[model samples]
Target chain A: MSEKHLQTGDELPAFGGKLRLFAMRFCPYAERSILVLNAKKIPYDHVFINLDQKPEWIFTFSPKGTVPALEYEQGKGIFDSNIINYYLDEKYPEVPLQPTDPLRKAQDKMLVEQLTGAQSAYYTAAFSSPSLTPSMVETYHKGLEVLQKELEVRKTKFLHGDEPGLVDYTIWPFLERFQALPLLGKQEFAIDKSKYDVLTKYIEEMKNVPAVKSYCLAPETHAKYIESRAKGNPDYNMLDTSAVCCMRPRKKKE
Target chain B: MSEKHLQTGDELPAFGGKLRLFAMRFCPYAERSILVLNAKKIPYDHVFINLDQKPEWIFTFSPKGTVPALEYEQGKGIFDSNIINYYLDEKYPEVPLQPTDPLRKAQDKMLVEQLTGAQSAYYTAAFSSPSLTPSMVETYHKGLEVLQKELEVRKTKFLHGDEPGLVDYTIWPFLERFQALPLLGKQEFAIDKSKYDVLTKYIEEMKNVPAVKSYCLAPETHAKYIESRAKGNPDYNMLDTSAVCCMRPRKKKE
Candidate 1:
């Protein structure tokens, strides 16, 4: 429940005897696993870590100290957002997030792959605005177009049919963050209603999805984080208000 | 069965009513799929394409005109080597390349993810020698260490188990090509037996894998291809010996 990001030399939190996820607060890749956990309604503890000043112990969970590593067992861990999400889908199985059909699963993975270019463009427009080229802008729109076209073809409430599945969850984080570009003065990156009517509708619908609604941050907040990160001093603890916790509940004796 | 790569203006070959894969002769990514297909004993047709001057029809199969695109059902296609291979493993369930266990599958994927750094270093050392850095070299060795460490822990004949699985098939193409680095004058990239005893033994065993032995090219051959590719004019048709028809048998009347 704590939003605070632990940094270097930070003590490893005592194992609470539950599934634990090591992640950064604002990373989209990390957000992906968070959304999956919420969707699966799985009980898990979250340990937010500062990516810039990563805690030494983070490497124990992820070889490269990357976020979104799942402490599945007491000391064992699994890294990578897709790997974690897929494992969750298979391991839990009660609330399957992927299609039963293998071909459809593969197709879902391909659609996710198609969005890579758009993700690159979004990163450029967000943190390296000056280096944002015309081609990248084109790629940004191409990503939207691909989503829109797929939406038209599937004709489903969500890309995953009646409910958003792995493809939708995997991609929704990027869509969530892309909305912040225009807020950050990158008007060219906007997903206009005129050009992306289907995609825009889908975005609005995704915002209401229970899994996404809880963990999703507002575009303005994302823009602020982007600004800080772009300035070379990321406010990793922006959401940690323990210092000013006037309404904080007193801790019970353990 | 032509080793020839089809270029622009080349006619699309008859589909033969069998599964077909679009690929380049020397592309490692393409080779990954080829190995999987061979391992699974799946009946599929291979179409080698000139990557630099790709045939127009390639896009019909893969939007980016990239190789290892599978024409799964006549004209319908699936791109990305991983996607295609996973689909193959699932579609043709007779020979499952991936483990059924979700955790083990996740671990296999993570290992592949860890190899990305080494792959980048290999690319630089092979094609852009001037840009190769000390850190890149270190990263490459780190990749080897990761594999060796996994082998030590798993204590399996192959990364996949007694029989080589998806993990082995996916990583073997890179190991095969890594041998070419030393032959190309990048001696530092060698997988020294003294340092990588387990990996060296594993490499030899992988070379003997029926799926790999039938399709694997020698280090000298890969070095020749790398040389041609680095010079900016890839010899896409170097393996096409149709022009020298002295030993060719005359076609029978169809």
Candidate 2:
């Protein structure tokens, strides 16, 4: 529960007997795994690390020092959001996040792949405003249009189905954070009701999804973090849960 | 069946009632799908296309015009090697390339992801000789070391156990193509028998894999293609399967 980022030379945290996830407070990729874990209703501990000054030990969990990495056992972990999410779905099949149909599953993965360009577009718009161009905005809208078209074709409440599944959890994080763009004065990134009626409606419904609502950050929070990160200093410890939780990293009793 | 490169104005091939895969003759990513389909023993037709001058129809399959797109139906197709391979495994479960254990499957995916850095290094060394740096060579070896270590730890003949599975099929293409590096005068990219004894032995075993042996090309062939590709013109039709009976692309009877 501690948002205290372990930096270079920091010791690996003691094994707490629970599955652990290493994440950055504001990374959309990391948010993906968290959403899946929450939806699966699994008991796990999360450690938010400062990506700018990554802990040397983080590499033990994530080979590239990127997250979200899942420490499934003592001293053993696997990284990548899709990999972790798939593992969680397969290892704990109670909720079944992935589609049973083989073709549907493949299509789900493709949709996620298709959205990468839009993610790049968003990053440029939010962090490097000057580099933001008409084409980038076009790419961003193309991403939204792809999502809207998929939703229309699927005819489901969520892209997953009547209930949100892997596809839903995988994409929700970006959509959740895209809302922050408008807050950061990037109004072009806004999900307007008129043009994206169905998508905006879907977004409204996702905002209330129990799993999403529980740990979801406000758009304003994401905007603030974006500002900090753009300034070459990330506010990793913005959520200081030390005062309220037993899960906080505390000094050892001598 | 002809290894002919389709260009901008070529007509779309008629639906042949068999699953069709769009691929470049020398593209490693395309080879992943080809190997998987062969391993699965699925009767699929492959359409070799000139990636540089892609047939207009290729875009119908892959939005960005990449190879290894699978047309599962008459006109519908799904792109991305991983996506297509996963679909093949799940849809044709006769010989499952993917492991049933979720953890092992996730680990398999992670291994592929980890090797990507080395892949980039190989690309630069093979295609842009001047940009090749000592660090790129280090990355290339690090990938080999990572594989060798995994082989040792697994104590398995192949990454997928007794039989070559998806993991082997996925990574084999790159290892196959890596052989071309030494042939292309990039001797630094060679997998020496001394330093990479296990990997070399494993590579030897993979070369003999039934599915791989049928389509696997010699290092000389790969090197020749690399030479052409690096010069801005890929020898897409170097295979010249046109003379082979019943394999050449011919006009359908009107």
Candidate 3:
């Protein structure tokens, strides 16, 4: 897995006969599928793409060139995080992430729906500060409150019960990046310890989850990326240490 | 089931122990659930709501006051058409609407995603013609082309199969409403026979489906509703012949 973001004119790396995920490093939606794949312990190849200067090949996997497209078979792709994640859950069936109870599954979907307002608010606050409104800030807290209430009601170690499941993975990415808001000087977006004691504990527990631990970026790192993107020149390859590591002898500079 | 749209002051109808769906008669999303309920032969009560002046209890069923909220239990409600429909499909199990193959299921979802652009274009052309752009028209046609191509590739009577499935039900509501666009003076939105012979034939077949035949409104009726809505005074109860039919003697006007 190379951290380098492939852009225009880049040839897609040869399909390695494993599941391949097309993603952008900082995208939450993309992180969702990645988390699901990791939790399932599915062997996969991750190809990070530069969204701003997307590789032409991306359209083959995702018609809209969006992140989190899964190439399940050679050249055949499934797009949309939820669609891909659901497919993975069903196809593998080894580790079922969704609730078995149909009503419970619908409720889980609703919880995710409730959090969408907060996600939108986070986006506006982080990327379009000028458009941030008081109502959006209120919506953000409302989302957190909804999560806390659900956590208290369920009384489970995770939303899916003893083990983290699809619902948890789907939402964890948003929470991971939300921490960056306060660091970016948006103090209003802070998840206050007192108001969100249960949620805070849950967040910490999620951070320690084996599946989340490996891919979770620190709030400061997210803040740096957010700052770069907000300024228009998104540093897509800022975290690419592959350039620094001399794994093999390089050719002479062109 | 009453065709009259209940407004803010309307009393909450007594739950009949059957699955009760809160919907607005002409809303495509609401119609999606209705079609599913019919297809599954689920015993359900339908309560129509005035979206502009929503019943206070609508929020009890759907927090966002959106339509197609299902009261699966006496008081417990499940919102979102897809969530409700999927829940019904899983819970019932007698008539499974989804594909058995996981990849096929994902592909079905992707097809619905592709049709969204055309749905949006139809909305703009029908509701906000002033804002309609040439690119929107192009996107609308592109969505149709995608659908036609999928139909050709699959070679199925319905997007799902010989029997209409979730994919067919999900996409059909939009196609049903799309017919109204031409009558609403947007001829450019018409499904031309030459351009979409397969789609045209498919649409005709879908119309004949017993579930669709009972619930689907004629294009003229839809166009009338669209006109009323566009004029800012949506005749929510325009088809409420219950008012006209005096099953019992009525008191004279005071």
Chain A vs native chain A, TM-score per candidate = 0.97, 0.93, 0.97
lDDT of 3 by residue, A187-228 (tens): 999999999999999999999999999999999999999999
**Model 2's CAPRI class?**
high
What is the DockQ for all candidates, taken in turn?
Answer: 0.89, 0.89, 0.94
Interface RMSD of each: 0.7, 0.6, 0.4
Over the stretch B96-195, how does candidate 3's per-residue lDDT look in tens digits?
8999999999999999999899999988988888999999999999999999999999998999999999999999999999998888778889899999
List runs of model 3 lying over 4 Å from the truth. A246-254, B246-254
Clashes of 3: 0
Error of 1 at B42 (Å): 0.8
Which lDDT values do the candidates have, in the order given?
0.93, 0.90, 0.93
Which residue pairs clash within candidate 3? none
- Candidate 1 chain A TM-score vs. reference chain A: 0.97
Give me the candidate number with maximum lDDT.
3
lDDT of 1 by residue, A128-244 (tens): 889999999998888889899999999999999999888999999999999999998889988899889999999999999999999999999999999999999999889888767
Q: Model 1 misses residue B58 by how many Å?
A: 1.0
Best by DockQ: 3
lDDT of each residue in B1-254, candidate 1, tens digit only: 88999899999998888899999989999999999999999999999999888899999988788979999899889999999999999999998889999999999999999999999999999889899999999999999999999999999999999999999999999999999999988999999998999999999999999999999999999999999989998888887777776698747524
